[model samples]
Target: MSKPRKGILIILSFFAIYVIWGSTYLMNKIVVTEVAPFLLAAIRFLSAGTLIMVIAKILKFSLKITKAQFINCVIAGFLFLFYGNGIFVWALKYVDSGFAALIVATQPLFVIILMRILQGKKIQSKSLMGVGLGLVGMYLLISQDTLVLSEESSIGIAVIFSCVLGISFASIFVSRANLPSHFFVTTGYQMLTAGTLLLIGSLVLDETWTSPLEWSGKAQLAMILLIVFGSIVAFTAFNFLLKEVSTEKVATSAYVNPVIALLLGWYVLNETISVQSLIAGAVLLTGVYFINSKKKIVIFSRFKKN
Candidate 1:
């Protein structure tokens, strides 16, 4: 592919990822009302992971790895897939999809802090400002009457925060660890490991499995779309794009996803979008823009100097 064509393809892949994955949050809210949260997530990841593994095998993708690489994959699976998505699934049981999405969108802010702490690097001023803005946005998201002081709401907030922390830690660890060169193959292994953990958790914690499925046909269809498009296709595309595109460009998905999720929640779930949400979303996006833009400006300046 020509450079321009390749860039366009990467950008399109990112857009697909943002839309599909963002919609999954609302779908989870719909489905979790009927399906067991852990059970549903287990099924989604297991199916997607199995399909990816089979494809990798058929393509003759090598699993050959050093012992260290295997360890890295295992840790990443636990942190990213197991803890990240697992907590997210749990949170959906109590929180509105829009609220959950707003919290999760703070992942980039967490990632920056985790990177600084783990790497012992000095924090950038822009990044600290982004973190502060994200914190303010998060406060705005949960300060409403809907999210106040109930036990379930508190638990849901904890779950969402746990997921954010897990992703932050996982991202930093993965940055320094040795990973497979084949992105699909690596992601397959991580997904498989994470899915298995979720399955085990479901079996242990969820005692009654015989509850009649209570979802409408529409919700069922949404679940299928979540697994196929959201978990499998979108995630695969995201991993591929990460390899092809700059991280800053890929990170734009963070901003795009919240907007998509908010709109979907409003239309499908009939959730009210508060003015606070709009303002917070805009502020969060602005912070992310400044943080990423600073990097680009630095690179361009060096190029000009050279």
Candidate 2:
């Protein structure tokens, strides 16, 4: 590929993942207004997975993996899409989409702590500082009266934050596992597995197929957008860009995501944004930047002069 063309493609890919993934919070909120949360998520992933599988076959990509790899995919699928994503959808029942995104944006904090606890990883000074700042930010975000959750929003925020553990552990697990050579193959199978399980769960919950008269056109369109743009296009772009760009650069999506969610929620849904929440969100994103960045954070250094 030519240099300029490659640059354009890279930019396009980044935009797809960043903007589309961010906007999905609002789209998901819209859909869940009509369809059952887990069922909507199931359909979204199932459709995306089937589409990607067809495209992979048409392009003659390898669709084969070992039994162990398939099992790994199943585990990751349940952790990531089934639990993490499903819980987020359920949380939207009581919270604003933007608020949920803000809470979910603390995923790195949870990941860092989990690594320390489970793997005996040493926490660096910079990480400690970032964690401190992130905690303060989270406190500010949740505390309506500046020091405590005002009863109404506590459970909703807690529910959203709980998914962070699922996603963080899943990410760590997948990082250590020897998965398929093809990104699409792994993601497709993972999505298919998650979708299948979610569908079964929905069935067990006695969720029947939502009729056209029951679900609005807006809800239908939102699901379609989530399946195509959010799941398929954004994920393909994300995997591609991870190979193209620096990891820290790709990690910027973590910061931009909540911002996009906040903006879209305010603009499209007319969701109220508190000044305290906005300030807290800014601090939270700054902490996330510090966590991802390599720029030296010199809290203090102890050196013995010889």
Which candidate has the top score in TM-score?
1
State the lDDT of candidate 2 residue by residue for 61-120, as single tens digits. 999999999999899889878988886676666776546655665666676667668665
Q: Per-residue alpha-carbon lDDT of model 1 for 122-226, expressed as tens digits? A: 556765666567556655655564643345787888888888778666655654457787777777777777788888988988634433356688767877887
Clash counts for the predictions, in order: 0, 0
lDDT of each: 0.69, 0.73
Over 4 Å off, model 1? 1-6, 58-60, 63-66, 91-106, 151-160, 210-216, 240-256, 294-306
lDDT of 1: 0.69
Clashing pairs in 1: none
Scanning candidate 1 in windows of ten residues, the lowest lDDT window is 297-306
